[model samples]
Target: MLRSVPSKSQILRYVKGLLITWKLRWRGVDCEGRVVVAGPAPRIWSKGSVKIGNRVLFRTTSRRTSIAVRGDARFEIGEKCFINDGVEIDVWKSVEIGPYCFIGNNTRIADTNYHEIDQGAGPRVDSISIGRNVWLASNVTVLPGVSIGDHSVVAACSVVTKSFPDRSLIAGIPARKIRDIEAADDYIRPG
Candidate 1:
């Protein structure tokens, strides 16, 4: 049997993957296991803490994914999650993304308003909790204090401003539950 040879692009990608892995480690990210970075490298700036679980894939393009954690905030992404290109996560408090979730391209998840409403008032900040098997469609904006429940799907270009229950089909500007979907047993992670 003849052995197959790796293409130039394949070899380049392999080298890039190794560089990215080393860069992440140098940046002090808490990676439990392997985290794959496709296309361009991601821009990660953490003044607090950043934790990534095993098998997390970041599919970046020219627009590169960005993650920023300010102050003593925490940012955590669970295992087997896919974060698409141009996704920006800015955490001023905490942002927790569960396992098996899909974050579509150009999606924005922020836990702070970034500016105060009043002169002496502080900016609004709170934690964002995304449950397991959740799918956030492209161009979605998940604002502060929003919790997306398990197995939920947020429609494209939707703005999530409130908490949603499990198995919700959420949509609209300030996202509301279009309907409740039947929970799929297959999505449950095995022990």
Candidate 2:
């Protein structure tokens, strides 16, 4: 039997991933499972709580993934979630992502506008809950206080400003439910 060996690039990638994991651990992130960085390391700035479940993969290469939380905000990601390159999540209140979710490249999930509205009042901060088995395509933007139901699919470049029910296919600028999703298992990543 012949044995296979890891290439140099693979080894380098592994080392970089390890370094990133260590940095997250040092930042007081409550990680319960193995979080792997498949691309470049992600930048996580946590001032409150950051919880990650098992087998969460972060893919960041050309565009880096960034997760930031300030004040009393909390960020939680469930098991078997895949976050692709350039995905940015900024939580000023709370953001919860359920299991078996696939977040495509360059998606932005924010719970705050990052600054005060009307130039005087405070920023609108609310919670974002993403249900299980949801697939958000590339360039999708989930604004504050939005809850995506389970087994839903948001098409590419959609801006989700409102919540949608389960098993829906959402698309377009303001992200309306185009139709109901019949059945789909394509979001599952094989072990």
Candidate 3:
């Protein structure tokens, strides 16, 4: 098999990603493994802890992606995860994403409401745990305190408010379990 060489644009993108990764590491972002920015660079603001695992691709070809960690909050993305353009993760408490997860474009995952309903109290803060091999489609919004089990697929434009079991195919405005994915491990996108 003949191997094709990367184009000039691809080379440039890789170089830019390397620079961005170095900058982020200087700014206290903990990247445990090799991260590839296949698209545009992402905006990462980490005041607490933001750990990204190996072979994690941030593909923001259309728009910029953002990850913010405030106070003592921790944001973690496991190995072989793919995060698309315009995706944002705001961690006020903690937000953990397991391995081989796919997050589509314009998705938002937050661990806080960001503001207090009552004047005297602080904002509602909770942790979010997303299991391994989960696929979240475009425009999906995962709210605070939500725990999505392994091998789950959240359809486009869905709002995940609560928890769901393993291998669930969830969809809708307030996302519900539409069906169970029996062959969750069988589906894999070709390179």
Candidate 4:
């Protein structure tokens, strides 16, 4: 059997991953175990805290992933989670991402409005909690004060402005539950 040679892009990605790994370690990120960073390096600006669990994968080939934690906020990415390219996470209060979750490309998760709407009003700040095994499709935007329950799936381009229960199939702008995942006839529960 003949062995295949690695392509130029593959080699470049490998090198980039190694460099990103070192960069993350140098930046004092709390990485519990091995973390894989593919493609370009992520832009992480933290003044508070960032915790990344074991075996987390960050795919940043198409675009870079940016994470910002301001003030005394906390940001966490649980074990076995897959974060696709172009994902942006802004935490002014707190953002907790549970294990086995899938964040599709270009998804944005923010816990702050970033700016005040009224002249004297302060920016809205809140916490975001994403439960285990949740899947947020590409272009999904999760606004402030939203909690997504375990095993829930939010469709692409959804704008989530509220909380969703476990096993829900959420979609549309200002996301509403399309149906219960387990209740669907074609739904197959993972063993």
Candidate No. with top TM-score: 1
Which is the winner by lDDT between candidate 2 and candidate 4?
Answer: 2
Angstrom error at residue 129, model 1 = 0.2
lDDT (Cα atoms) of all candidates against the true structure = 0.90, 0.88, 0.88, 0.88
CA RMSD for every model? 3.2, 3.0, 2.4, 4.2
- Give lDDT tens digits, candidate 1, residues 70-187: 8899999999899999999999999999999999999999999889999989889989999998999999999999999999999999999999999999999989999998877567
TM-score to native of every candidate shown:
0.89, 0.86, 0.88, 0.85
Off by more than 4 A, model 3: 1-13, 117-122, 184-191
Q: Give the TM-score of candidate 4.
A: 0.85
**Winner by lDDT:** 1
Window of ten residues with lowest summed lDDT in model 4: 182-191
After superposing candidate 1 on the true structure, give the runs of residues whose Cα lies further than 4 Å from its correct spot: 1-15, 118-120, 185-191
lDDT of 2 by residue, 43-155 (tens): 88889899988778898867989999888889999988999999999998999999989999999999987778697788888899999889999999999999999889999
The alpha-carbon deviation from the true structure for residue 72 of candidate 4, after best TM-score superposition, in angstroms, is 1.4
15 Cα displacement, candidate 1 (Å): 4.8
- Cα displacement (angstroms), candidate 2, residue 11, comes to 7.1
In candidate 4, how many Å is residue 172 off?
A: 0.7
